[model samples]
Target: MEAKKNPRVDIYRLKNVFFNFGLMISISVVFAVFQYKTYENATVLDLGSLNKTTNEIIEIPPTTQPPPPPPKIQLPKIIEVANEELILEDLDLKLDIEMNEDTKIEQVTFEEDLETEPPEEEADKIFMIVEQDAAPVGGIKAFYAYVGDQLTDNYPTAAARMNIEGVVYIQFVVEKDGSITQVQAVKGIGGGCDELAIEVVKNSPKWNPAKQRGRAVRSRKVIPIRFILRQK
Candidate 1:
């Protein structure tokens, strides 16, 4: 016979009261653990060690060196020399040189010009009269004498006019009738002198015919016609 409980204080009311009481105990315990952890982790900060870091050194392999250059080439020298043995020695040899010397005189025959000549033996040996009568002097003198007067007269006037001084050698052939057949100047002294010499010979009179043995013959003669312009 307990005292009579209030009707309002039932099982439902007891359950609510117990649940609220447990919740309050659990919250208080969590708040205490957080405050203990924060207090244990607290420390002082060092500003000098804030920017510091560690440095490491690494080594690499070394490179190789290059080789040296090659040497230069040299040329040989040339020298000139003359051979003396070939120049001084003689190669050819000869024998048998006969020399004859006379000490004594034997005989000397002097022939004179025989006048009234002997009778010719051969027909070709005869001196024809016509050739003998034509140009008695058959040499170069005869040619000059025959043309001298003509040259002297004709060339003086021309030579004085031209003032040429030289000797012109004229070669001409005399005909059997004692006249100059052809005349040519072998040497000239220019300035109209050579032409004057030819003119002189061409104007010459008939000459004495030359004779070979007994026959008349034509002969060649060389005459030197001089043209000298006198200096006043």
Candidate 2:
């Protein structure tokens, strides 16, 4: 038995053409997916006004103040008075004449005693060098012993801390009455040493007054005080 078919309406004849068309459409879709570009919605800020600069010229008004008033003047008062006549008397001024070589002029003596009593000698005059130099009440060694005893406890803290060692020269006045006066440091190495030396000398016992021409006199004396730090 032979099967009969229509040749013009055959579907199997276009199979290759339909396959190629489907392949080309798949390739175009893949290319379009890879090359796709998307736009984003962004807002831009306007900063042109912030970047612009303007210079302004301002005017300041001057202050207006009134001047101060002048000082008030005072006028003197006038008074009325009665007129009076003045009477003046004549005076006689005659000096007696007495002038001769042997007329014996009496000596004029002052009732208030104008002799001026020789200026009552200056009491505070101090002598630099005297016949006898002033000495401490005890001998020099004993005086130094007392000073050493006092200074053992009176060492300056600053001087001790820094190990400061030096001699302080002090000048003082010995009065006529065996009293010490005007004790001062002539030269010193600082650090509270000068002041401490002055204090110790001021508290020392009175010294034997100096003598000049067999009379007790005020005199100046200079002494050196050594500050030595001992090892602990």
Candidate 3:
């Protein structure tokens, strides 16, 4: 019989495996002991004192602060206006008041339009008709001569060119002060003669004013201004 082959000859090569398995078993045993073992040194806390109540009852008082006041708005101090009855209401006070002296102000009076009244001298200033009619500064012939000479530049060329021959009647207010004013055409001969006649009369010099009861007065004067053209 050959020497009995050592069947466990390779067991030495697996010795590291056995060693690792032994290390795992030791770790497992330590974990099992730590998980199952009880310690006598644990401190026990009693919660019975938390449930116990004293005889005193706590009471919370209601809030004592008042609500805040409304915000204030800043406005202009003085406001001026035309004469009118203005009612002012004071928001801070409960009453409506008028502006016065004790609240400190002066008196005010109303006035009328000054232009409506005229002076005494100008009261009988204008009259449409008087006792004596107003005359030009010169006699009738001299007045026509002056009119023709003054109207040399403002001649009715349109009427002359068209051979318009007719008389233009003009009306005017000869003022009390001998001034010729308010000259207007009564009956017009067209073709520019109407406006020309009126314009010529408007530029006439002062006249001898009309007389009413021995006093110089305004008078309505009507005159026939001729616009005769010569045939060429």
Candidate 4:
């Protein structure tokens, strides 16, 4: 049989509405719980205690200095001196000479002094070029022979070992007395050849002094000495 159902008691028709209302209420509760916040109390500072600070003052002491010393005083000194006496003497002069027209005066003579020493002679000067040049007692050839003889016996061992061969130029001064002086080697090859040449020339015999205007003079002479190494 068909029966009339009560709209209020038929809960099936409102089931959807009940379910949607419950869903909305649950979402609102969940949102409220997530958005909740709690606050803590703030800390307070006491500025009244720090406002009563006192200012401190520092004091400096004064220093006392000693006074400077007084200046020194000096007294003047007095000296006594004796007075000296001066004596005066009288002088007498004679003026009683007489002159006549017949008086004859002897002739006055002024002779030169013969005892005075003559002016000193100047030192002998050396000449580079003279009218006649100095020569050895014998001849130039003879002089060279003498030199060779002197050097042959005492050949420098250094020169021979090194085979040094060259001419050594020797210079010497010939005095006014024809004696050889100031013998020196002007140019030479090394290896003791220069000293040997000088020694040989120094011992040479006297030469004829050079003449300049027929007067003997000191002169300079240069000669070349040959040094050769001989093979055995």
Model 1 clash count equals 17
**RMSD of model 3 against the true structure:** 26.6
Candidate 4 per-residue lDDT, tens place, 1-232, comes to: 9999989889899999999999999999999999999888988876675566787886869878888878777767777778878755674655775779987888999998989865533346778889999999988999989988877888899889888889999999999888989998889897999999998888889999998767788999999999877668
Report lDDT (CA) for all predictions.
0.68, 0.87, 0.79, 0.87
- Model 1 scores what on Cα lDDT? 0.68
User: How many clashes in each structure?
Assistant: 17, 0, 0, 0
Residue 203 CA displacement from its true place in model 2, Å? 0.6
What does candidate 3's lDDT look like per residue over 118-191, in tens digits? 43344356666667778888778888987677555566777777877878899988877888888999899798
Tell me the tens digit of each residue's lDDT in model 1 across 115-144.
867554443232333434444346557656
Taking all chains together, the TM-score of candidate 2 against the true structure is 0.48
- Where does candidate 3 stray beyond 4 Å? 1-129, 150-153
Sort by TM-score, best first: 2, 4, 3, 1
lDDT of 1 at 189: 84
Clashing pairs in 3: none
lDDT at 220 for candidate 2? 92
For model 1 the TM-score comes to: 0.36
> What are the clashing pairs of model 4?
none
